[model samples]
Target: MKIVIAGGSGFIGGKLVDLLVKNGHEVIILTRSKKTPSKNVSYILWLQEGAVPENELHKVDAFINLAGVSINDGRWTPKHQQQIYNSRMTATDELVRIISAMEVKPSVLINASAIGIYPASYNTVFTEKSAEIASDFLAQTVKDWELKANHVTQFGVRTVFTRFGVVLGREGGALPLMALPYKLFVGGKVGGGKQWVSWVHVEDVVRAIYFALQNDQLQGPVNVTAPTPVTMEEFGKMIGSVLKRPHWLPVPSFAMKLALGRKSKLVLEGQHVLPKVLMANEFIFNFPELKLALEDLL
Candidate 1:
């Protein structure tokens, strides 16, 4: 399979590309910058405004649309929120435009969504079947972002949306930042420590991407989290233990609220999500337990 990853140079996408290449698939990565190529990887400069470079479209078997802005990159100021919205919508729109114009479009499109589409509350266990999205910044952003990709289904391509959990990994996702305070022994619980943290190991996330692509029956939103969901407090302790550190320090709710403003849900709260679709489809997790996952990554 020849796969084109819209944002494949980053952490999760890069890892997935490595595996795809190892499995004898040709991969092309779309980047915003001009750079030299690496072994078995080709980088194409993608200007989201115009049509995709026609030379890169030949014989493209699948398109993995994982391109998006980080929702937690900075303070979610009204201005920054607009950047988040525009960056995602623009990239997604361009991906759709390019793929739609292909004489032989990719067989499948795996779009990335988040569990953030669910309310960041412990009051519910969110499944792929859940409806009525939460009315929050993340919810609104993901809802619009996903709708843009789902439109590609009209081109007769199978579209699969992976509503991700807190992706626990070693590289530049959220784990590296989480390790900072913990390394100093200030690693403590955020908010009440009761909020559910649905998480998946980075390897599992990469593996799940291929699993979804290979299985033609997969469509719609699929939760990419572990089978067991842990609370914030439990997560903190497990991580601390894995790193051989103390987990006594606690960051208060007031501090978190002040730090993040309306975007405090990134840490202050999270939903209990279940990977119903992935499991029902017979997907096996490499690191299903938090301790095991953290130990491997740490």
Candidate 2:
């Protein structure tokens, strides 16, 4: 399959591209800058002034949109928040236009989504079937993002919104910063630690995307989380155990709010999300347990 990926340079996108290439698929990465082409991979310039990426792209089998501003980049000021929302909307809007112009539209479009769409709750478990939508900034962003991507389905493209949880890996995502406190031996539960942490290994994230690509029956929203979800306190303890460090020195919720402002919600609050769609389809997780995942990454 020939797959075209937007935001292919991102943390998850990079890994996904690697997996697609390794599986003998031709990959085209849409980027703002020019890059030297490699075997089974090429780059196409997009999201720029006077650039028509659709003209250069042809016979694209699959389209994956992972383009967006990172919510973890810094404090969510009004300007930064607008950037986060605009980035995703602009990227998806462009993809829709490009697909509309295509003589042969791609079979599937797997847009990157987030579990943040679900309201943060300690006891409430969310799956793809959950209809309760959170009104928070991140949740609203995801909701609107998915709505934009849904336009692709009108072109007869099978759209899949992979609502990702906290993706854990060595290079990027939330692992390094979360583990840093433990490495310095001051790590403990953040806030009450009762908030759920629905996490999945980066490898599993990549594999799940691949699985969705192959499974024609899969469409719409798919929770790309692990079967087992842990609370923040349990998560910290597992990290400490994996690193052989002491899980002491609790950080108060006020301290986190003071430090991260609105972004503190990323850690101080979470949802108990499960990948029910993946499980029902018999998708296997490479690192299902938090300890095993932490050991592998940390």
Error of 1 at 204 (Å): 0.6
Estimate the Cα RMSD of every predicted model relative to the unseen true structure: 1.6, 0.7
Model 1 Cα lDDT, one tens digit per residue, 1-298: 8888987876778889999999988888888777787766787878745526655679888889888777657888898888888888988898898887788888899988899999877778889998858898889889998899998899898999988899987766778877778898899988899999998998999999999989999998999999999999999898899899999889999998898886777888889999999999889999989988998988
What TM-score would each prediction reach against the true structure? 0.95, 0.99
For residue 169, give model 2's deviation from the true position in Å: 0.9
Model 1, position 54: C-alpha lDDT score = 52
Residue 136 in candidate 2, Cα distance off native in Å? 0.6
Candidate 2 global lDDT: 0.94
How many angstroms is residue 219 displaced in model 2 relative to the true structure, after the best TM-score fit?
Answer: 0.4
| Model 2 per-residue lDDT tens digits across residues 66-129 | 9999987888888999999999999999999999998889999999999999999988999999
Which residue pairs in candidate 2 have backbone atoms (N, alpha carbon, C) closer than 3 angstroms, thus clashing?
none
Worst 10 residues of 1 by lDDT: 47-56
